[model samples]
Target: MPASTSIARARTDAADRLVAADEPLLGLQLRCGGDLPGVIAIPALREAVGKARMLGLKLARPIIAQDGGDSVTAWVEIDPRDDGCLIEFRHWRAKPLPAEDEGHVARRKLAAERQIAELHARLDARQNVLYAAAETAELAELAARMDAGRGRPWTDFVTIPGSAHQQPLHWRLLDGAPVAVAGSDRPWRATLVPVGLPGAEPAGFELYLGSDFPAPQQAEPSPVAEQIRARMIGREVAPVLRQPIARIIANAETIRSRLAGPLSEEYSGYAADIATAGQHLLALIDDLTDLEVVEADDFTTAPDRIDLAEVARQAAGILGVKSRERGIRIDAPKEGEALPAVAEFRRVLQVLLNLVGNALGYAPEGSQIWIRLEQDGPMARVIVADQGPGLDPAQHDKVFEKFERLGRSGDGGSGLGLYISRRLARAMGGNLTVESAPGQGARFILTVPAADPAGH
Candidate 1:
């Protein structure tokens, strides 16, 4: 090799070696912090500082705080040949200390290296045997939501319209069941149950009214409409035995309250409501769990339904927690007027989520997003208006287009959410339309007719 080429190769090789060296340090730190990527620098720094501290050596670079104490930054100087970052726990502490063991300095340095090596080996071993728990946390949250539903059909979550090639075919749970799924050709054998099996069963959670999958080739519905409908319900075997669930809560409350007379009949009735509500929520969840699965399918469309007003209320209730989290208000009519729509509840909810989520995200931290339902003789209209920056008339259609960024890409976007949503509404018996000019806020209108049944 020529001199210049050799020098270039040497630089590349040296950089690769530096990156390799950093991996082990970062891995060890991640292990100690229970897989937290943030605290990685801490353990890595201990190794970086070990030799210097043991030999009465000092760092050429000073330690510094970053992000106003949110994180700590430090530099390591080692022959300029090694290029890497160092991590030390001394971030919280203002300064570093050199030890006073001059006589035993060499031995201490050896001991430190041995200790760090052993520790790193142990952490590596654990990492190898175990798994990244973040995935588990996600499942746990899903399970919690499922449990909240209490034996209702669990719909998979989908947000974007796609071939689902981007996602895994299915997700296996720690317990070995395929609890979640996506991008699959085969129908799952087991009805994936969320972890909190018995926990979210508060009351009378019943299964779906029936297993009547819609006809797939019904023009508007997909050619795979029946399959999608089957996919929608998934497997919600049965509701928690409501009487029993209510008994459990009532008994617990009775035990805690020390209320006499074997608890009033009304107390049990109230207990039943919690379980009933839980079951209703789960039924709603079964409707919702499909949010992600459907979103991921490019060909996915909406099923026809009526009662768009009820869906709006249902959506408002579902989003109630999210809105309240950011001090935002999601308004529903105190006395709602019936606005029938031939549409899929889930698809409609998707629009609600987008408009609501967008409103919450773009509007001032504390603002209200309203879902208003209005009815005229043959037509019913549902409006979702956000107090955020209204879209310009030019951008109205563009905003509904897929992958169209409205300055909210950082909000964990597939960007196709709105496009799929609008498509879903149109696929059913309605069209999702937006009305707003630049300076004013935006309003999304979902209009469907009254002739359709309660599919909405």
Candidate 2:
């Protein structure tokens, strides 16, 4: 067998093998310009192909007719074999003859050619719509799933290989990952491959927001956002405590009634302890819920240009009793021209109460917590400095960490207070920072942009 014949035979056999497997290949290259095979065929397509070949020849390059035929309609595909060449058979059909006449054949050939070309144009158009529709559905599913993931685990970028085809990964600020449902009528390959985020590239592919894998979160939220989320967790927790809180209140009230007249001393002690613990729990709930709601921006703020002195006075008033109970002194700066600062008055007071109250907890009995107002470049500032021992230099930065305690959890604390205060201050366009040294007490500085920041 000649080498050429051997190759042809191998191709013809390979086609037969694939066809045997029930996959009838289609010639669909005329669609979407992507060279897709086996989608649609035109009438007289084989005749038109022969004519197209003839048209490309020059005088010296007259097209040779394949052996024993005036024109070749289909070519055999020679596929590789382990021990020998395999031939694949392919067939194409053409209708209408030119009555075996040269002119008639030419005319038929031309007509067939025109028909094939038109069919190709239409097929290309159809292919575009097929892929486009698939992509549209994918994008829609992606958006819906993203919105639904508002509070679920791990969202953001999806890094799938080959996520984009011939095009650079498209979206600049994609909000959610593209989730896919298997077995859906959607194009998986050559349309969109899942990819990674910017800078996280895989060789031979780019990052896409849609993928078949899950991402592991690399970092935690920012401190401010962390604080917000921590407080907001109260909303998640309130349900669990609602019944318990109600039960406690009810039980306490029943015990206090004592209509049986003079309860036992041991019973009275138990009641008092229960009431104290319950009241403490209630206060914590209120604090957490308020912080959460404020941070969520669901509640309203009443901003006013009021005297800082008055805000301090109110904060001191509320905190003073608590301070006195702890034997701590709170010193408020004397009214100096009633220096006014713009803020959510109530929130400012809340911050003051939290901070001052917190300081008193650590201050030695009879130590002072001082509040003073001063000015720095482009801002008016309030300083809450305590005479109590301050944080260690190693731990100063950690002081604002949620649930971080100086000593123990039972030391009258939840580590969320400073975290919430700092976040709240910043959310209002101000900031709170600290200056401290171990055993030397700490000074917290809260600064805000003044009405005329420079006092100009």
Q: Which stretches of candidate 1 lie above 4 Å from their native place?
A: 1-306, 335-338, 407-409, 451-456
Which digits, one per residue and each the tens of the lDDT, describe model 1 over residues 405-433? 67764344545657766766666656778
| Runs in model 2 lying further than 4 Å from the true structure | 1-261, 294-302, 335-337, 452-456
Q: What RMSD does each model have against the real structure?
A: 21.8, 33.9
Q: What lDDT is obtained when candidate 2 is compared to the true structure? A: 0.46
Clashes of 2: 29
Estimated TM-score for each candidate: 0.43, 0.44
Quick one: RMSD of model 2?
Answer: 33.9
Per-residue alpha-carbon lDDT of model 2 for 180-215, expressed as tens digits?
333233222122221212254311111122222222
Instruction: Give each model's whole-structure lDDT.
Output: 0.42, 0.46
Residue-pair clashes per prediction, in order, are: 28, 29
Best by TM-score: 2
